[model samples]
Target: MHELGIVFSAIDTLEEVGREGSLSSISSVTLELGEVSGVVDSYLLDCWRWAADRSDLLRGSELLIKAAPAVSVCDACGRTYPTVEHGRVCPYCQSADTELLTGRQIEILEVVAT
Candidate 1:
């Protein structure tokens, strides 16, 4: 699945970073995942364990993910609302000009290394 692919990508990046930083070993990898990023955290983690085991650089690495809350800004009345509702129209002014403020990102934040 795509989760496996994503995990591999993260592991590859972590390995490269570890080498660039002169790290002896990677202990953990922290990721920031948006609620609306369309990724399942648990699934990604499960895939990570499998894929990481295949790599010496990431064999013992821990994957830590932080879920980011969903938020949206309305263009009509300059109001913001929770994007968890998943509505195209703004709840405040009922306008369709709402833009997403956050919760659509998948990023690697930090790496814990020895």
Candidate 2:
């Protein structure tokens, strides 16, 4: 699926960073994942395992994921609620005018080089 493509893109980015830092090997990578990012953690991990081993710089690297909660802000209520639970509706005031404050994120946080 798209996880494989994401893994490839991450590897490419890591390789570029490694080159810039003159790093020969990477020990681990940390990714900050949002609750509503739509990227499955298990699938992403599997893809990482498969792809990381193929790259010289990331042969034995570990992929770590940190989950971030999905939050939504209600315009009418001026309050925040969990996006996964209430979605676009504000649970407090029952308002349909809401916007997502967080989640839907997929980004690299840190990389350990060896």
Candidate 3:
């Protein structure tokens, strides 16, 4: 799936960072994942394990993911609500003018070098 591609991209980024910092090997990587990012954790981990093991700099490295909740703001009501619960609709005012505030992220937070 696309998780493999994402893993490859992450590996590339890690390699670049390692080169910049003169790191020989990485121990772990922490990622902040959003609820609406459409990335499956199990799939991403599986991909990471497979891809990381192939890279000398990333072999045996750990991939840690933190889930971020999805939030939406309603323009009509000027209020925020959980996106998973109410979607684009504003629960308070029953309006459809809403915008997603979060939950579409898949960012690397930290990388630990060994």
Off by over 4 Å in 3: none
Ranking 2 against 3 by lDDT, winner: 2
Per-residue accuracy of model 1 over 60-111 as CA lDDT, tens digit each? 7899999889899998999888899956689877899988999998889988
Quick one: best TM-score, which candidate? 3
Candidate order by TM-score, decreasing, is 3, 2, 1
Candidate that beats the other on TM-score, 1 or 3, i.e. the better one: 3
The most accurate candidate by lDDT is 2
Please list all clashing residue pairs in model 1, or write none if there are none.
Answer: none
- In the range 21-64, model 2's lDDT, one tens digit per residue, is 99999999999999998999999999999999999999989999
Tell me which residue pairs clash in candidate 3: none
What TM-score do all the candidates reach, one by one? 0.91, 0.94, 0.95
lDDT agreement of model 1 with the native: 0.86
Would you list the C-alpha lDDT of every candidate in the order shown? 0.86, 0.95, 0.94
**Model 2: runs farther than 4 Å from truth?**
none
Q: Candidate 1: where are CA atoms >4 Å away?
A: none
